[model samples]
Target: MTAVSTEIPQRRELVTELPGPRSRELAERRSAAVAAGVGSVMPVYVARAGGGIVEDVDGNRLIDLGSGIAVTSVGSAAPRVVEGVRQQVGESTHTCFMVTPYEGYVDVCEKLAEVTPGDHAKKSALFNSGAEAVENAVKIARYATGRQAVVAVDHAYHGRTNLTMALTAKAMPYKKGFGPFASDVYRVPTSYPFRDPEGMTGEQAAQRAILAADKAIGADQIAAVIIEPIQGEGGFIVPAPGFLSALAAWCKDNGIVFIADEVQSGFCRTGAWFASDHEDVVPDLVTTAKGIAGGLPLAAVTGRAELMDAVHGGGLGGTYGGNPVACAAALGAIETMEAEDLAGRAREIETIIGDRLRELQATNPAIGDVRGRGAMMAVEVVKPGTKEPDAELTAAAAKRCHEQGVIALTCGTYGNVLRLLPPLVISDDLLREGLDVLADALSPKG
Candidate 1:
């Protein structure tokens, strides 16, 4: 129901080769000014973006499939967000919530309480990024529960900061030589239906995860059990049904906080207000960012009022945790979501994407899996007729996409999953064209 703004032409128009002269110049400048570790999938610098297309410095208008890693679900430069930010910036950019405080922060927290899963009383703490929100959620859990051990799932990605790095599962890139990470963080297996032994049921997968955690680290000692309802960086791995409910029940029984890291799957991107809504799983705490504030940086951790209140006064918050501009943008973003019924739009997009990808799977043996919900969908690339990951092919296919003016992103621990996260306001024609271009990139001739 969210309307695509008419200001942006909802079509793909390529006027130059990918990474033309202007982009090449910017890349050269970036190499000298930016850190080598700061990597980007597509180095073509964005000059403008709206609807489903991003115009690069080289004037290459490519179909946007990655919504700035899912931050612009309301669309980049969403009218409400732009105007809200403009007004807030004029009034005051930062009063530092800890110092003078502000109404914007309170308003955002109220919206979060109203929208996040469950009908119980809730409280929230704001932060500048998803990582900060996660870090603080962990802090709140440990402080409230008086437990030190944290349990995260296999293939989980929390964040890059030292504490979150410990919670994270990947070694290369995110972990590498960064450790020795913080202590008492445990990793347990989760239901990844695509890779699990054949015919495993949701109940069975949940029990396996439960047993893994109980045996490795006594659940009584755990402060929190955090997971992504639909794992994002881990290839959009949707856990089997009942998996989340089982975890929630176990946490409640053990006095352990259940946290859902909804950084990528939240804010109506997953055909629901939150992915947890799909499973009727009410998390004790939910960490959100990404699409929460259109393109402005804002994140929050909303949890049960009792647990949040358990923390000492001034236990949470940072200088720019809830910058007025970001808060204003979040307000406008939430208003847009509710007014437009974006959850419905996400479901509509899911049908189109799922059907098209399934059709591709019918012919392309390299497509091992097509999974995910709503706008948060992805396809796994495997060796022809085999489940073994074909990361090389995935990389090559993505390169092919880039050369042809399509912004396709490749993710997954195995580096073989092609993720699609188009803006919610993207036109149906634009989505079809993006899919067609993707089909061409994956075609045998390509």
Candidate 2:
């Protein structure tokens, strides 16, 4: 068992409105100094957080249903994580892993090897964000296989970096004006069952994509096919059974590396430890970040030793890739997950949230589709029977929930999907309360 030292910290109380006077003052200051491109989910400025709740500077308490965009899987301000960060900050902060190796960084990598999927000899390299991990994954795949081309799926969100933007599908916000991007990144159809051609199964969609990749990029020239098992931003679309497995098999047969961008789906966001496990498919390389360190800025690319080692010495690294604080936090987060059985909790949330949303779909025709694995669930909002997306309604519902004290987020290529990412540690009572709030927000007014 990974040892963890946890000391619960004191929780703060909220006394004012969400963006209380102080927070409003700060937001005004931020508007002038911060970049205009940067956006915030909520106007509330966070003062303190513990367990599953966040206290705003205005003294308003909120149930963190989004987990800071799925980063705080273990919980916000988890005792073990906080304590680890506290201890590590005093010892040292940054000594670039590439320049001066650190034990915490190495230890985190060792932990990643043991926990990240496959039993085969594995290696891991850390990065600062999910985008860096993905960009490096492409580098490793291309270097190892000597291929120039890469394939990604539609509605997939890899990251914001140049190479990642080329891999990402949406253009308006992410890719617009950010080109000319890295060369040889290609896109294919995604296995979106709800929107798939009438009778096509998930496997059929995968096959079609494979055929498209073969024709457009040629299997021999493709270095890797990176995808999210469950598309996070593209409406939480979970591909049908056999889709991932079939694709993995095809990649193996063609000597193409299959990379799973599990930045959002791994670490028990799904019912299983990794979303890929749901299909019994082992990817050649897995890139993860969001929840790996329970809110710390840490990410990793874990892969087969051979593929990772192919990169020459001094090829993969960053100045802040594995800051000791982040590494310590990761060790603490992993320990918290194991001891608390957070993976099992994720499954439990899926059953509860999925059932509740299914019931909502039956009554609310606006809910065109409800799909996802484990706690990463979402409902597609539409205009009754047709697929005419109701992005406006989605925004209205989200605003209603926020006003009613439950923080929720909307996603999708069309921006019509409402995603729920409550902390795995949230109590059953609190979960029910948050869901009730959501129902009220989406309920038809008489």
Candidate 3:
């Protein structure tokens, strides 16, 4: 999208067997050097990546449908991001925004204000990850509203930190051993149209959640109601239309801050600047990370000026919160998204994924659902004749794809959904080929 064609060929090419000799050696080294707690879905050491291809140490060219978990929407080596970061690092890498204020930090915040929904005057504070942003957002909400409780929806994935782990839904991998989490964090039901009862409308789903939240944590005690408009890491579930707006309205009337965790759904990945734009919902605060800075480690909590400014001076400063290099990368990433209108490209991706996935669904009953927006589509793999999850089948299919040099990622509370997050700049030929490979992987003889 930014005249940033990949140096590597944009195709899945298997030069050797899966986990080729070089990759196998690297895995062995990693096993020795890295902590066992860190898990990697694919162990092939990447040599370079750009556009839609990742070339590994084995020279195996893998078509990246996952986009490094949706962090490289503008391509891994987007020209703007690289150039911006290179210039910033040459000048100065880290002065620490709090110690010596720099313009890059303010520039990134300005870009956030311009892109995020709402014309209202907004301010932002930068952080290092989505979890940090969420933690800080909660802190601000509590300080501003004088409340202590935070409500999040089921199947949500806020982060891996102590506070975020409590906010997340899945427990096995994220919150299993970590106990004695932060207090006053509540979980409420959310709309999952595919799994909800028959004939339930958006308003009904909203009411059910609202009532549940009230019963669990009184509205007066609630500091914020946080949710992912398009629930990422929770099956890529797109909630029923009007469900978000209804919840936002409820938050407004109850004086609770509405927080949209747009970590994976923001920055033009969902056919809009943010998924909330699809519903025209203006969240009181938005948490963004993944795609915001291309591939840099950057995140932000942007919201109305009054709420953002409520925190005491020195209450939110961090050592590396808004590193100048990361801020520059964010600006460059934002520039590329704006100049190319990646949101429009995302819509094109949706059409491709929707048409192919739906066609496959019509023939293969195992795909119980194909739902998502733009390049963020996914299929809930289930038993052939029912809605029961088939995590075994899903994992097998992913392994088969990985074996054939196609990089795909699986997610969901049940680990049964295969999520596709190809870069918005991917060529049509590559996307089609990638889908064809996936279709083959799902077949019996593939």
Instruction: Please report the candidate that would top lDDT against the real structure.
Output: 3
Q: Return the TM-score for candidate 1, rounded to 2 decimals.
A: 0.98
In Å, residue 221's CA in model 1 sits off its true spot by 0.8
Model 2 TM-score (2 dp): 0.96
Worst 10 residues of 3 by lDDT: 1-10
lDDT of all predictions, in order shown?
Answer: 0.91, 0.87, 0.92
Q: On residues 143-176, what C-alpha lDDT tens digit does candidate 3 reach at each position?
A: 9999999999999999999999999999979999
Rank order (by lDDT, best first): 3, 1, 2
- By TM-score, how accurate is candidate 3? 0.99
After best superposition, candidate 3 residue 32: deviation in angstroms?
1.1
Q: Residue-wise lDDT of candidate 2 within 307-419, one digit each (tens)?
A: 99999998998888999999999999999888888888988888889899999999998989989887899999999889989999999999877776677998999999999
lDDT of 1 at 385: 74
Q: Per model, how many backbone clashes are there?
A: 0, 3, 0
